[model samples]
Target: MKIYIVGSVGSGKTTLARKVSAKLQVPHFETDNFVWTRHLKGDIRNEIEVRDQLLQDAIILDHWVIEGVHKDWTDPGLQVADQIIFLDFPSQKRVQRIVKRYIYQLLRIEKANYKPTFSMFLRMFKWNKYFEEQMKPEFIMKCNVYDHKLYRFQTDKEVKDWFHQIQRG
Candidate 1:
């Protein structure tokens, strides 16, 4: 089963992807990894050709789970996904989660792909807002034709319920 999970910061995209990957026994990919070359100092954007190729390579796999906030260049993933899970929690909830996650990362209780600096924390809020105000509509429009394969959830329970009965769907 191929799954593409999309959500803004603090919407639990990585957590959900990890869970699904383990349950389905498929390799999991993160769009961030494709977009950036992480370093101790910071992340640098991968070249467009390199980034697109990495994403294409992952989606071509027979079974995989990919997660990210990137929609502009990830239509390929959407097209191949047998299931597209959108974590559509409200903006307020997302902001709260972002704050809590920052706290955990700050305390070293949770590991992040990038350093959890205050600047990055602030950017998360901005990214979350951009997602709601700008990207959400476009994303929904793109997924409209995939209604048969799309699952949108506003709460944690709703996502859990869908996952438990995923095969049945």
Candidate 2:
């Protein structure tokens, strides 16, 4: 089960990937890990060839679940994915999650890959807005060719029910 989950930040891609990966016993990965070299201070972007190669290696595997906000560089994963989940939640809902997650990270309730700063917090909202205005429409256009394998959900219940159905049948 090669599943690729995509959405804007705070759309719950990581949570859904964890759940699906656990239920299916498939390895899970984050495109962020490929896109940026994680560091204690700040993440550095990986070279394009390095990022592409890493993604290629992962998608070529037997069973995996990968999630991210990445688009252009991830077309190969989209092409190979047995299933693609897009959590196209409304902007307000996503913004709320971003706030909640940032708070959690600030209080050390939740771990973050990078330092949780006010600047970073502000950037998340900015990214979300950019995603709403640009990324979503671009993704919709790019993913139309993969409609047969794509499963888009706007609500948690709908996603859960659809996932359960897939697990059963």
Report per-prediction Cα RMSD to one decimal: 1.4, 1.1
Distance from true location, Cα of 97 in model 1, Å = 0.8
Candidate 1 lDDT (Cα, 0 to 1): 0.92
Q: By summed lDDT, which 10 consecutive residues of candidate 1 come out lowest?
A: 160-169
How far off is residue 59 in model 2, in Å?
0.5
Q: Evaluate candidate 2 by giving its C-alpha RMSD to the native, one decimal.
A: 1.1
* Position 149, candidate 2: lDDT: 94
Which candidate has the top score in lDDT? 2
Give the per-residue lDDT digits (tens) of candidate 2, residues 28-85: 9999999999987779999999999999999989999999998898999999999899
lDDT of each: 0.92, 0.92
The C-alpha stretches of model 2 lying farther than 4 A from their native spots are none
lDDT of 1 at 130: 94
